[model samples]
Target: MSLRKKIADSEAVLNWVARRIAGYARRVYRNTKWQRVGFEELDRLADAGEPVVVVLWHQRLVMSPFLYPLDKGRICTITSAARAGSMVGRVQHLLGMDTIAMSSHKRHVALSREVLAMTKQGVSIGIAADGPRGPERVLSTVPLIWARTTGKRVFCMTYSVKHGREASSWDRMLLPRVWGNEGVFLCKEWPHQVPRKATEEQTEELRLSLEVAMNDLTAEADRMVGRAPWEPRAK
Candidate 1:
């Protein structure tokens, strides 16, 4: 094979191996305790037969799969173009989810359309708001835009782990130890119909509201895990 082909092949092999390891670690060492608090709030919306956009922090993806039902309708989770995201997509698929690869810079328009398509087809949309890269816990406008365009409500999902492993990466990636306490926080449905001609203040207000909703749900999860409001790591 050519040198470039050889490199690509090797990288794919490495990714497969890494995903296997992560999968094993999750099965053998990770403890996932899923608690449903106010899940009815989310369920009521889903039961309404309306499209919804789900948002969470990038680093908390580890615990997200547990927040959702294993048999829930397919969700379109946003992922990175990186190999790690490819591995994550494989894992998510194994967990019975559908995913879409996206890049903050290059795939914006394409991903936006993909999300819209999913919504129109009655699939739920999932986003790691502080994802693909991040300024941690900060909100991104992509999901907001998708919600506004599709007339979908934005629902914030937050998770906390009582026992888990942490990576030093941005978003402080987490790996819950087996039987670790996991809590899911859901916010009431919120309108995302900001007009294309919305005022600067109106846009900022919407962004601020999203941030607060995320922080609120995150805080509640931490409380469920008995952590102080100031704790940094997932444990």
Candidate 2:
């Protein structure tokens, strides 16, 4: 009955409405003709009860929920504590994913711990390598670190649409066009592994390798959809 309580209730209702609208938009946009490359490999790994760290660029987040089969198992991803993060978490939940709230700007020890635990339980973790904020497509070493720590493989995947719009955000976020042709490419697992005592230089090397592999897969996906590779604008 208090004024503050009433305002909080109204805000909660508004947030729920916003999330519903966003989810509806996603469903509409992603109702496309989809082609998958390398999904059988993912299926094989999952059938063998192997954990994986699913890695993708931040810009490609739009279509990611549709890339994997929900029957595989639960996927855990990290989000921030911001309002936007909350909305994203809700959207992901609707897509059958679990989210951990953590800021990318700070130390990720807790996030790593939780993700590692999830992987140990045979639950795959999905990460937007250059996300939360991005220099778009630049690789982050978090996925590699999780793979090393959990003894899991890193599966790099990316997708492109034949017809879509790109948001002018920091990541040039891809917005799919309904009924367009969409192509998804999944790369083979990274061959190299980071040891528990991996040096900073070694970690950097792994990061660079991941970046190249992800970019190559993304480019191939674009080509499959008859689109050119995405070129980032000059800073």
Candidate 3:
């Protein structure tokens, strides 16, 4: 066998092993202590024929799947081609979730198109605003971009555990105990009409509004779990 083929084979094996470890981790992590809040709004949104776009921080990506309504179908999650994402996609499939793998470099024209279609069909969509990779709890413009494109409200979601391990990864990845309490806050977006020549200032202001709303939701979740504002330290 050529050296390149051998290296490719080895890479494939390594990726497979990594995926197994992540899948195991996800199952074990969820079996611990877990609690949920603000789901009523989620169900209500679904009830009102308002297909929503759930925007959450990257750290809480795993928890997002479990927090979603089980009976509802037509839901889509935006993930990536990363190894961790591959693991997540597997778990989501097990839980009956439909996912769409997205690229950070190239925006998929189909993503917006599919989201609009799903919304029209009364299916919900979720975007890990700070994900596919991330800078911890920071917000991204993807959620806003989708909202502007699809004409749907963006539900800003966040969660924290009273006790658990916080991965040192970019998103400070959270592994909440099954007995831990989790909270979801909705930052509903009702986009205004923007001129074809919308100013950068206007765009920045909208983004800032989203950031503030999401941050407040995170803070509220912190309070629910009895912590200081914006401090997701695992106590």
Candidate 4:
């Protein structure tokens, strides 16, 4: 067999194993004792068939599959075009979530169209606001852009675990311990409606507001778990 083909096969096997492990993790997370706050508010929106662009910090991405309201409807998230993004997307798929494969630096228009269409179909869009690559908790304009284009409310959610490890990565990604006490905080939907023709200044204002809301929720979650507020590693 050729060296390239052998390498490809090895990678395929590794990805398969990773997916299976992640699937088990998802099951464990689902069965974890998670204490939720403000879920009713989010449920009310779901019950009313109102689509939302769910935003959270990149650090919280690890708990996404279990944290989101998957029972309400389909949830879609954007994944980058890189190899790691592909692997992450596969894991997300294994957890019954859909992924849009695109990068922040390319094919944004296509990404926007897909997100808008999904929201229109009542699929809640999930975004690690500082993801695909990030300056940690800094918010990306993608969610705001989607909200403005689709006129959907953007909701922020965050969580922390009493027993977990923090990765030595850019986002200090949280790895929830099995059977850990997870504290989830879902903020109320953003009150303002983003106009389709929102100006740059208006969009910046909204983005900053979202960044604060997400950080606040993160802090609240950590406090509930008796942990200090999570700080992203300095780049």
Candidate 5:
């Protein structure tokens, strides 16, 4: 990446980045011919009438703001309390999302309570399953715990761009070009969760299941967009 790009992405320019992030995101969204594959059932949830938890990878955060409708359903997402996270929350706000800001290290019962309340109010929540800190694509148990505690279904969503640069970040973030490409691929039909009465072992089993499901979903999206199904590293 160029020094100019790195500087623009740095925390020093975070405020500037945050201000334009949503617009850039929308611009990218418009520029790409997005192909939605098998999102019909997921779309029925309304994100307002039947709130659910949407699990996404941290790497694809850029275009995530457009995953749900802007004028209809209520959508909420969590972000870290760190400086960079503030930018993320701001971007979501600019895209008309409600945010819960929490420190990754200390996210606890309080966060769960807030999420539960939001779910009850029909606000669909989006969680980056491997985020804040990550062993790249290694699924965190937080979303599983939320599913069990809130009695909400968990849905896996992913997208891939046919024209984009893969960032050198740990998660290999995709940076899309401004003009256009063959297409973008997206899907959110897979619904999974850990049961409320799940034992520790059962929870672990469910966690791995959801993790693989997300990886599989992402691979399918990539294939649809004309990209080889890339490896989703758990490391």
Candidate 6:
């Protein structure tokens, strides 16, 4: 009943707050002037009618929905089966995204199968590489596995703003101003490949390399928005 409790976004009631969260996201997205990078390639790829894996750090999740070309195809993201994930699903739904709400009871293979099926059905999969929790900004190899299996190249995108409030959370999530200056959304195609037969050691190395690449890409976006880069915490 306290003001502090009421003001916080609690996982227990996050689903209930989806509308307000989505509304605020839209206001910030539309009100800010965003310099977009690498979308022309995305536009072309979308027009080609095949799906690709879109990956971003969980901290930059705020404006991702708008980056999807809704008219060209459908895209979906996975969320935990926990109540917090349910809240994310609600917000994604409100923002015109399809969500695969993962069940805690399901086996890892089962979830991977479901994701593969979605890709086969022309659904683009979006992943927060360090999501559902974090070793913050660490790239998960599972998405790379899907990219290998489904033959979808990965595109990384992230954003930063000149006017925003950075959360005190582990990933330092930035909540951009609803109205103000500028921001930048930068995207790039990851040129690395995850070979189907790659050994565990190779995959692990690739993941670490990817973590650095994505962190640099994020830094570029932050710099574009006139801010210093946030260093990677996950090694």
Give one digit per residue, the lDDT tens place, for model 4 in 1-235. Answer: 9987676557677588657768656755775677777777677777777777788887877667766677876778877767667766778878888988886566767777778788878888878898877988888887887777777777888778777888787788787776645555445566677778889899889888888888888888888888877665555
lDDT for 220 in candidate 4 is 81
| Residue-level lDDT for 168 in candidate 6 | 81
lDDT of 1 by residue, 78-155 (tens): 777676676666666666677887765666667667777888777787878877768777787766766677777677
Clashes of each: 7, 0, 9, 0, 0, 0
**Candidate number with greatest lDDT:** 6
Q: Give a tens-digit lDDT track for model 3, residues 1-235.
A: 9987676457566566646645654664555554556577677776676677777777766656566675754577877766567656656665567777776655677666766777788877778776766665556777767767776666777676565567777776766554534433334343443334457897777767766777777777777677545564464
lDDT of 2 by residue, 1-235 (tens): 9987676457576477657756764764467666677778787777776768888888887666666556866677776666656556667776677888777555677766777778778788788898777778888777777778787777888778788888888998877776644545455566677788889998898899989989888888888888867886877
**TM-score of structure candidate 1:** 0.80
TM-scores for all candidates: the values are: 0.80, 0.85, 0.74, 0.86, 0.87, 0.89
Better of 3 and 4 by lDDT: 4
Worst 10 residues of 5 by lDDT: 182-191
Error of 4 at 33 (Å): 1.7
Whole-model alpha-carbon lDDT for candidate 1:
0.68
Residue pairs with backbone atoms closer than 3 Å in model 1 (clashes): 29-178, 30-177, 30-178, 31-177, 31-178, 31-179, 31-180
Global lDDT of each candidate? 0.68, 0.75, 0.65, 0.76, 0.79, 0.82
lDDT of 5 by residue, 74-183 (tens): 88988888766778788988888899998756658878888888988889888889887788889998888777888887778878888788888888887788686655
By lDDT, highest first, what's the ranking? 6, 5, 4, 2, 1, 3
- Which scores greater on lDDT, model 1 or model 4? 4
Order by TM-score, highest first = 6, 5, 4, 2, 1, 3
Error of 1 at 51 (Å): 2.3
How good is model 4 by TM-score?
Answer: 0.86
- With candidate 1 superimposed using the best TM-score fit, by how many Å does residue 168's alpha carbon deviate from the native? 1.1
Model 6 TM-score, 2 decimals: 0.89
Between candidates 1 and 3, the one scoring higher on lDDT is 1
